[model samples]
Target chain A: MSEFVEQLALCVERGKVNRESLYPPDLHGQDGTDELAKQALEQGLKPDTILEGCILGMDRIGAKFSENKAFVPELLMAAKAMTAAMTHLKPFFQSGAVKRKGTFVIGTVAGDLHDIGKNLVAMVVEGGGFEVIDLGTNVTTAKFLASIEEHPGCSVGMSALLTTTMVNMEGTIKAIKEKYPETLVLVGGAPVTKQYADKIGADGYSPDPQGAVAILNKKVA
Target chain B: MTSFERLQNRMVGNPVDRPPNFDIMMQFATRHIDKPLRDYYLDHRVLVQANMAMLNDFQLDIVQAISDPYREAFDLGLEVSFPEQSLPISTSPLLREPSDLARLTTVDPVNGRRMHDRLEAIRLFREKVGGCTPIMGWVEGALAEAADLRGVSTLMLDLFERPDWVIELLEFCCEQAILFARAQMAAGADIIGLGDAVASQVSPAWYRLYALPYERRIFQAVKNSGGIARLHICGDTTLILHEMATSGADIVDIDWMVDYQKAAEISDNDGPAICGNFDPVKIMLQGSPEQVREAVINCLSIGGDKNLSAAGCEIPINTPYSNLHAQTAALSEYYSMA
Candidate 1:
């Protein structure tokens, strides 16, 4: 990696968004991922290089999260940092100068309003260089199918916090499989288990956000 | 001995046959009475009837009137959405802005709409079950209530950015918690279940500084009012076990993520009496009776005499009846051996 990419990656890993951001107090008054990514671009650094830096940083944090070495706040801060870098790259993506890895549509399933878990997964996956289409909470099976149609060949992730709503995962998974048999369906949440995932014919299940990124990466790879 | 005596005796170090089993059950109880969950939770009469019926059928020890965490927030002038088939959720936080705390006022449990509903549930439980069963009243702890009033994500970031705002919200929460718990005591609740499930989101150090002090105040109020306090924290709490023990509660209800071995070590024979540590979904809801028996036996050995048997958190509504019975049925196996 180039010097600029390495610095941007370090900023994302340390959750430094910009000099004005206050989350990681030790990094205060420092140029964060937002500033460094823009500077790197201004200096003619490749957009792909900056994106790879984000992927590298998110991979490190995602692995840590799966090991329970990191908590929600750390992951959120890291995602925010990645978002800062991604904002500078968005114009490149729209101008066809950059290519996204793939689309991953995610949502908290019907009758379940909780979104923190789903939001975390979306952020980490986005930082992994995927274009994430997040359909917010209380999403029904029809909404999921529509999202899949909007982003064909996209991997789908469903979350449900309540045990009552977890049962809905089965129908959602089955419907997606019925419509797009080749599409991957991922299920997770507080009440979701590997056994339940297998029972519902889900392609994968991850207890944490990092694991979700790993699974989505694997299936697409 | 009555269920109340069994628990009360355990509280004061009196010998009891075994540790009493107390669980927070609303969805599970509604399944027993065949009422829609919304119906059961909306009316104190339905909530009381469904709980008593579940206690009798499951052979559990407590008749608890605990519902969702949105009750107190609802009474504080926040709109709570009631889905016909799911638990009630707060649609928007009561304190969206820091200055909004000025508009907030302490709620009178006897006259407040949702708080009064819970009080009536307790009084009705007292009338019907009397001293035969221990009745528990539910109150959201400072951190949990603050999260509800200001939205969870907002409150979490506030802890890092605007901590003063979080503290002020918590102080306001303590005001409502005292009134809620005290009214339940006057209405004949044997214990107060202080729920701060969101504390699991932060590290033990953060919990100690931001969450624990306010919890200590609420527990002190409960103890002063002659009502025992039970601290219930849901989700993975392995890191915060020691800090959680300092809340001055009589019992700490743990979740599955913290096994009984960790609970035993954290308690160190000095912490609050420990109850639960079983996976509500995996062990009680989906597992067979034999699996339930095995888990109970394992928990008993790990807990020794200071443990109570319960699901890690709220018992799921879809949990099997045989699995529920096995929790109590296996207790006999442990008692006979001892």
Candidate 2:
């Protein structure tokens, strides 16, 4: 059972989607997350155990990505493999056999339509076993407020790629904080920094999606 | 010395009156001067005035005519969303399938709305400056233009799922970029700036296989058309700096995450001037004038004496005017002593 969990975790880390998937060159034709995860489940592994394995794999990949040992392409592949395995476990989650730690609300701020950064964060956060509420790009402060209201205790993350729309982050941050002071808000993007995050009263800032997951994990923990 | 001479000297690896302080000006800044975004990007006069404001107000060395990445993508018939006071975005990607390439038409730079607008901006700048300051004409790099045509997510998938299709699309983008480069050169642009912000997202292997060839083609196109090429790939490009330098561009614009010294060592030459490596938000938007100056000094030291210019990525529109002033002041102070 422990060996199956370890293999599932390694599959997620290396991004092996299925037995036939040829990605990661070295892992070509090997049993992927799909087979390993199903085996784990058929062997009576709990849903929580499967989720814990995923979290462990994603945490490792995210940290490696943040430190520059891994790039976006690698992370995307890992996320894809993780998603394939998670699909099998979805039934368990839907039946209330397993519960996600918390919800995360995220979007690129208004006037900024870029979504790659936001999407990456959403994917990594979701792989970390959190319920992600993606608002898409060009999201206004009102939209974010509504999302926060819907999720209640959920944390929010705002992204901006353009220099112009980064200013709008400040307004969105202010509105969310004013309406829900207890709700945590994280900020990031190409033009964002820790200083700007602090200046705008955002609770956290991460340079990459892995950092964002780390911050979210810490907040939830 | 005149700004033109100062820029020329800096570009050629010589000491100048000061380091060249430049920014890839955005249409969002036009709101500060009360011009609508669409009108500013369309009208050469409005674009020039906005860029002039950036130079005059901030002492920028080169006044750029970069409005957004949509111009080339738009000409290729990609659906785009235009918003007020923000860059226009590609709404629907142009390429839906690999076979769709046969139906796509190449846009002549002189005939298209956005490309023509950019060309006119360069022409007007040449007429206005005429050796007073260097004017930069803009083009989208192949991968970035391809992403605009195929949607970023789809393109990333295409790299692995359909490598041949990615190559075909990139070829089209490169051919169009060469044509665009020629038109800007004809319009008297001293330097052609290629914006490929999306290239940073790919792995170095994919970059070497897909992006590098097209970059080399575009760089050669600019040089053959009698203009210098300045390649700007926004984001963390540290992994591919060695591959990037071999593309033969005259200048490379480093984003905030790449270290200047590393880029210099990888380029293995002094004349391929590097423009940036500062965090636009931390040092330009949020930092004090003193901090901005310190950042500039750090960039200069890391870049060494070989014709290094100063800028973070694109300067933030809301960056304090004093922060910019301090940047230029530091350049002048450093150069004067050198």
Candidate 3:
């Protein structure tokens, strides 16, 4: 709740990456998340406390997106700001001075080259404190299994933008569950619905990025 | 009545034999004719064959030239690759930096290879079904073309990072789209469908600022050229439904996530005809014929007089023939009862 931490949260929420960043003109020439985080740490603030600022900022922007009060541009800017602040916290995370919520592996299912929806969820989830492993586009069932083996207990998220490709999510989920029965699975995209998620036996379905964060948080909680 | 007459009449709330089956089918059409997606995209002859098959077999009323979104981007110097069995993709965006905007040139649709291919398709459609069916040619919405050339995420960030540059890029894209749309119209297209799938992802404010004006311009050009303008934006467009209604288009595609009743209410009496609001994945692809029939009936009932029958977007390529038939049958049955 100190001055720098508060400003850092504001910077992330407004998407001001640094002082040189001209975005969000209201905060022009002001210290961004990068400077605020460094200053907060130099003043002996706990890394965990500083991390709270990032989470709070992302949560605020994520909620706005969910309510239709904001859109992809705002969320992308917030993620960029969060990434700028995370650069300063990376060493703390490596040294075990900070901890992440969980791991979420995501990808666009096979035969569907669209990645905008998948990437949005990955960025928002990362800002929500999860370690995200984005497998990129055209991901097959074998790739999902391999990533599960690499990151044990990591929840999986699959995306498909086409109706034809959405069926691929079912086969991919079935293959993942067959190998790692305990791994949580989620499916989402423009064509995916909650009913289809249930039909495909996915653990959860989210219509938006913050909704994905909520689902992932619920499972771990 | 001819398919062309049915569609034109339906848009103006005139009585027709049945609601026009305006389902957007590209992959499904390719599968119906058993052609590779690449052939369907790159070869106008293959595209014409696929569409003709859909018209004969599934009662589809529109012969469309919408193979992929890359035609404009590719002709504008973007690196596009068409996999044999997959949709086209542009791995490397053309505008990597803000200054890269200078690299874009105004492309003549008639001279550009991919754009010319679409014109060829329009010409063929006119030759084959000129008077009987509506021929729809397509172009990307300006914002969508910008996203295609600059990448979705980067352009999104650019909207905030460099507002003026984004506007300039949009202006360039708008000019190209207008040119491509005009070319198609000249080549015998009765209707021009503009796909702005990325527009649904932006907030209403951004949509009004960056997307709507360009859409207005393109639709205005289509109308001025004596062509029907159809606007198709994929995904849940509930928030911007009102704005979409005012975009100068004659028909606006309503995706499944949007409420059909709400769309009709928002458009009211003076707006464009509502063309869809069914779950292409759940009800059309995965549902039985009985379910598809009921969904079409329900959608048409909600959409009222100014409605065209269609799935929310493209039907899945593997959709059962019976399910597709159910769509046409439902229209006939519903209208007969009324």
Candidate 4:
């Protein structure tokens, strides 16, 4: 990694939110992701290089979470730190300078009002440089279709926490496939299983936010 | 041996004629018998009748009065939305900002809407069948109650953004839970059921820091209040099983995703009994009677006869009657032979 990019990645890994924030116990009172990203940009680091660093840091955290070395709280801290850095690269993204790998549209399927899992996936995926369109909770099939129409060629993810609402995932998957046969759909939740995903005809199923990132990366890479 | 004797014996880890079966029932099913959701939770008569229905209808060994986690949250002044036949959910969430804690007041269990309702239910259960069946009182574990108070999203963020605030909130919730558990024991609950489903969402480290201490405190409080404590977390808790076993509960109810054999291995302590690992949906809600029997047999095989029972989480509200019979039938067959 480039020296500037490596510094950016370290800031994210350590959850250095900004120059002013005091956290992580170890890194208190130090320059954080915000200052490092700005410095990287001023030093003429390419936007893609900075973006790659964020992705690498996020991936490392994701793997740690999957392995049980880190928890949701730590992952959220990393994601927050990555978001802080990404803010510096926003202008580049807007000006067509840094391109996102693909678009991912996600929501908690109809009848399920829970959004924690869905929101976590959205945050982690956004950190991975994907244009994420979050539809929020209790999303109906019609609403999902509308999102797909608005962002054509976007991959879709459906989530449900309640067992009763999990049935709605099947309906949403069917509706999306019938209307847009080519659109890839993913499903997940506490009650959702790989078997249920296969039975529902979804293209993928991830048990955790990191798994979702891996699936999205494989699809768009 | 009678179901009551069997369960009592198992509770102390004494040798039983055979393993007993216990299941946590959902309050939403009370609506099927014409009781409103809130009324079923509030009225002692309604709570007793509903639980009695479960015992008489399914021959369950233990009966519990559990409504929803939103009860404490609602009494804490959070807005809650209650559907006709579903669990009540908090609308506003308690932890919008760290400063919101100062504005929040602790609810007295006697005067609180949700806690009082649960207490009334426990009282009714004791009056109706105190000696015949074990009655379980319910409280949300610190993590789950905190999630209900703080929206799940904000709590997840707080875990990252504000570690100190998370610790403070969990401590406050634990203090409240001890008070709640004491009141329930006074109202005649034999066992206190601690619901901490949200803890399953976090990794083991977060669970160890934010959940385990509070759970141990609550469990110790329940025991000190002259009631046995049962911990019921509804999700895949495999990752945190070992830590959870150390919470000092008398019974640990395992959800569908956790293998009972794995839980038994992790629980290493001999005091707390392991209660379940069946998939309520697959076997109880939508399976044939034979399949249900087979599933119970499988669960029992994995759980073993010592300090084990039948159930996963809250038995699904819409589980088929015949499938439920199959669960009892399997239990009866096993115990009768023993």
Q: Relative to the unseen true structure, what is the C-alpha lDDT of residue B197 in candidate 2, on a scale of 0 to 100?
A: 80
* Residues B1-338, model 4: lDDT tens digits: 67668877776656676677676676435744668766665566776787788778777777777777777777888888777655565667666888998787778899997788888888888888887888888889999888888887678878767788888888888888888999999999888989998888787777888888999999999988878888888777888888888998878888988877888775454746788877877767767899988878777766654545555776666677788778888876766655
lDDT of 2 by residue, A1-221 (tens): 47666777888888788888867678888989888778778888787777877887888888888777776767777888888888888898889898998999999999888898898899899888898999999899999999998988999999998777888899888888888999999999878778778888999999888787778889879
DockQ, all candidates in order: 0.62, 0.53, 0.80, 0.45
Pairs in steric clash, model 1 = none
Model 3: per-residue lDDT, tens digit, A68-137?
Answer: 8888889999999999999998999889889989999999999888888898899889888888999999
- Residue B303 CA error for candidate 3 (Å)? 1.2
Chain B TM-score of every predicted model: 0.96, 0.95, 0.99, 0.94
In candidate 4, the residue pairs with backbone N, CA or C atoms under 3 Å apart (3 or more residues apart, or in different chains) clash, namely B94-B149
Candidate 1 vs 3: which has more TM-score? 3
Q: Model 2 clash pairs?
A: none
| Deviation of model 2 at B86, angstroms | 1.4
In candidate 4, the second chain superimposes onto the true chain B with a TM-score of: 0.94
Q: Where does candidate 4 stray beyond 4 Å?
A: B15-18, B31-46, B266-269, B336-338
| TM-score-based ranking | 3, 1, 4, 2
**Ranking of all candidate structures by their lDDT, best first:** 3, 1, 2, 4
Residue range B1-338, candidate 1, lDDT tens digits:
88878877765546677667776688989888998889876899999889878877877789888989987899998889787778887777778788899999997887798899998999999999878898899899999998888887778767766777778888989889988999999999988999998888876777888789988999899999988889998888888888778888878888998867888775555668788878899999889999999988888788756677787898898888888888878877777877
Query: Model 3, stretches more than 4 Å misplaced?
Result: A1-4
Q: Which one is best on DockQ? A: 3
lDDT of each: 0.85, 0.82, 0.91, 0.80
| Candidate 1 lDDT over residue span A30-123, tens digit each | 8999888888889887889989999989888888777777667667778888999899998999898988889999999998999989998999
Q: Which ten residues in a row are the worst by lDDT in model 4 chain A? A: A19-28
